[model samples]
Target chain A: MPSPSSTKPKVSALGSFIVIVWLMVLAVAAFLATVVPEIDTLLGRSHLDRTVISAAQAAIAITTVVLLILALSIMKEVYIGRKLR
Target chain B: MLQAITVVLYGAIVSAVSFFAVYFLVPVMIKRLVASGHVVQDYHKPDKPKVPRPAGPALMAGIAASEIILYILTLDSSVLAILFTTAIAFVVGLVDDRKVMPGWFKPGALLLAAIPIIVLGAHPDHLNLIFGRVFIPLLYIPLVFIVIPIAGNTINSIDVLNGVASGFLIIATIPLLVSIAIFGNQDTFLAALPLLFTTLAFYKYHKFPSRIFPGDSGTVLLGALFGALAVAGSSEIIGVIVLLPAVMNSFLFLASVKKIIEHRQVKARPVTLLGDFRLAASKDKSAPITLVRLILADGPLGEREIGIQIFKLAVFAAIMALASIGIQYYFLKDVIR
Candidate 1:
């Protein structure tokens, strides 16, 4: 029976957290591109190989998809054993 | 001149085909859904208004047909990829509409929908940035899997009110089309037109006091296509920026509820209807937060007013998206080869 007005702060906190998370991701992606050598530049060196970049990208991609899929599974069970509302 | 005119005329034919398909079929769909008892009650009203709920099939048919025509004209692999991903998204939604699946099912199933794009060789490995000056390669394929589901769900999450999904899409799509055409992807440009026009046709019936709901099928189909268009056009940044509001709605909902349960599944309602049918924010601590509830925080507002507020935010995001294009063209001007 909590009044609706008091519920604002908690929701606001979550909203701010998510928006910040997205912005942080954007910033990081932009930063990573700035710092890391372009793939072709790295590939031209006798010592450097495309496989290294491919492996890194694959690792990041797979980990993100895995984490997201896991999140979805957890959300489904949030109200576990409860009847459909 | 003649060839340009031919493409123009052909584009017109494609637009007409898409528009009329959704336009003519929606009324029949409303009748059929109502007759078949596939309806949902509008809880905000005292009358407990019931609305037909099968606009998805009509939308899917229109989009599929128009995209096929675009593919016929261009023989673009990207065009075909868009059609398949969208149809798959629609079917995934239909599964939910026919019978409730666990909250995870649709998102999980949508992952497979990205396969057609990859298998068709439509997605390329390279990220365009700083006006196409900065290229990050080897990121596209993995990102494709993430983009499809996120887009489908974001669109689904924003369909809380009547016409919001289709209307918001019209605004969100303007920049997508602009950026695609300017970026010189003729096939994706032509492919995207059908989506814009299709949503325009559906918005006619989906607007306030709606006769029918887009349901999960309509929303997810549109969402997936929007994402697919971005992927195909190689304009993921533009699409993401244009859809920021809907993405925020998804983020806000998930962060608040800490789960993926349906809106109807929430124990406490986010907004409460007053005697005048104006919706006010819910005070219950247990009620999950939503964009509507957050908007209602200042005071109670009618459903129409709330819908307008969401549109206003979407337009602002569209402008921001357009600005990114401006930045690209200005800073990346030399790369306009």
Candidate 2:
């Protein structure tokens, strides 16, 4: 098996992108939890409104899954087989 | 006063039985499994030693026997549910150890294990976070299903190095046990004591230059039990924070791989070997990202040294978990109460 270069691994552009996106997703989740509830109330919705809660829940879930897919596609070839020269 | 004494006696008895069970049963399993040609090459060692594979049955026997004694002394449905979940995970892993199942086998099968907790109704709909408690309500049921598979796999992913799984497990378990005590859940504390004793005992042979491997059965079973205990104790967030290192390892691997697959099935080795047998980070961009690979990013290190680094990371995460307890206190006046 070909060996990896014995050097420090500088953060890849992809790594930075993943980190940034992950933080953004977390921020979005927080927004949904704190801000989105207030938004619902402003719109004449009660605190127990299932519609508002599930909508935020769906948004968070979809955002997370989409980011995961993007990460996989970015690193797909790199992860599966060693493209050693 | 009499009840206190009996509780102490039960704790001592359960621990002793658990310790002895693994201490004795392991050697027998080693002899039997090695004799049956079930040994695998210890590729990480310089000499490439052959070690008996997957002594999970012995560990499970120790745990099950200890749990049975506890139930006999104090019948707790939560205790039985945890035991059943862990045993199911063990069987899921045992199948993989004995035969090559498809990659989906372990994860798919472990979902069944979570059913016991749901069926026992041991988990509440409320989750305690660092800031405050949140009521997941109906979502907690789905969370159980997600947690079991993730827990089983996350711990299994960290079993890459000798003694890493058991040692990390022992380190990670302390906070949970502490939380249980703080909550004054004495019955649950007694139930959890044997788990600690069994894993601690297994480490005697499971440390560097391991005499035997925990295999899938051991890792998955241990992981499942860890998760179950977290749910049963209502300390899921604490458990996750304490296990952040292992959880990070699992996430890095899964995110890199883009799918559910076993480490055994991977073609690209994450860490490559140097002439001295120390593992160096693979410059191969194609290599799967892993905790060990990231650890070696600066340079190659000895296997035992790498194990120490991982343990240190776990300890650091555990301290963070402890800090979160303070956060919980700050948010909720009666945190444990």
Candidate 3:
């Protein structure tokens, strides 16, 4: 393993590479925003659109519900009879 | 379907590219600048052994680049609300990282950072439902002040262990991406996806027994991202939930440290002497042990012991994640169907 001092040059190089990637992304987003249609018809934009939206909402809703249940369940198991940790 | 999916996929690609490009650039520039001025400025040289040279400047530079890309891509008042809140935090952290600002100044900086969210209408509110009333906003501005900074510090706290804070970053963004897909918030999703990808890539260097520490800049970036995403999604409660792991860890760490300091003060009798001794003793400790001392000094434990404590925290967080998923399932399964 490289010592701490030895790591800086490698990190700096990686940082440079990340910056290049970021610029490329900007270029692509710009190009796509201009050249490609905002909504795609072939995939039946309306249907997939709703599906995507539902997926997003469901994911959040599910995540929220799941976390609460898990936390409560764990709390009940770990700290129920005993005082809270 | 293929075309739309392709477009979304392409958007993800573009986002990833842009975020990395900018994040990498700022650090190099900062490093060069620092190198030029190295003779004048005395870098932090410790009396004790140090681990990796502090990557604080590099992390700050990366944050600056990320913020700049966020601003450029999303525009001045874009939906990437977390970007600016985090930027404010980063600025505060940067000041501290450079000069070790007085302690009270940190909270003051956080309070200052919360202004953008309040001004931008990202304040938290709860509904008061009686009879037919709907969406009645209450106690919002105060809540925004309390919550944003708390969340900001939460991200800062879990950063104790390597790669831990980034784990929260990845977790918190899941919903943002989900919300974007469902609500046709493609613009926001496009913006966030890159940040997520960049963090993942950076994690390669940041994983356990780490190579590079993300430092304050990375933590602030994440906190800012959480804040921005909360505003854009218009779900303050969910925002807090997503960040529960980090927030809880930070809170626990603070309480733990506070208790330790108080205990030490009591032991040392003259409470003032405790701080003085700690300030002096910090120089004699191992670098990693210093991290433990600063953050987890409720009791003196070895590295393995600290790792266990961290693991317990992670498991605790993982449970929270699972619960969050369960709760959403209960309320929305029928609707989703």
Candidate 2 - CAPRI tier?
incorrect
Clashing pairs in 2: A4-B283, A78-B286
Residue-by-residue lDDT tens digits, candidate 1, B170-218: 9999999988776637777788899999999999999987888998899
lDDT (10s digit) by residue, model 3, range B134-173: 1224334655666566666666656655556665576566
- Find the number of clashing residue pairs for candidate 2: 2
Ranking by TM-score: 1, 2, 3
- Candidate 3 docks at the CAPRI level of incorrect
Model 3 interface Cα RMSD in Å: 18.0
DockQ of all candidate complexes? 0.09, 0.13, 0.02
Deviating ranges (above 4 Å) for candidate 2: A1-85, B1-6
Clashing pairs in 1: A3-B283, A4-B282, A4-B283
- How do all models score by TM-score? 0.84, 0.84, 0.55
lDDT of 1 at B80: 92
**TM-score (0 to 1) for chain B of model 2:** 0.96
TM of chain B vs. native, candidate 1: 0.96
Q: Which stretches of candidate 1 lie over 4 Å from their true place?
A: A1-29, A38-50, A53-85, B1-3, B131-137
- Give the range where candidate 3 chain B is weakest over 10 consecutive residues by summed lDDT: B127-136
Q: Across all candidates, what is each one's fraction of true contacts kept?
A: 0.03, 0.04, 0.00
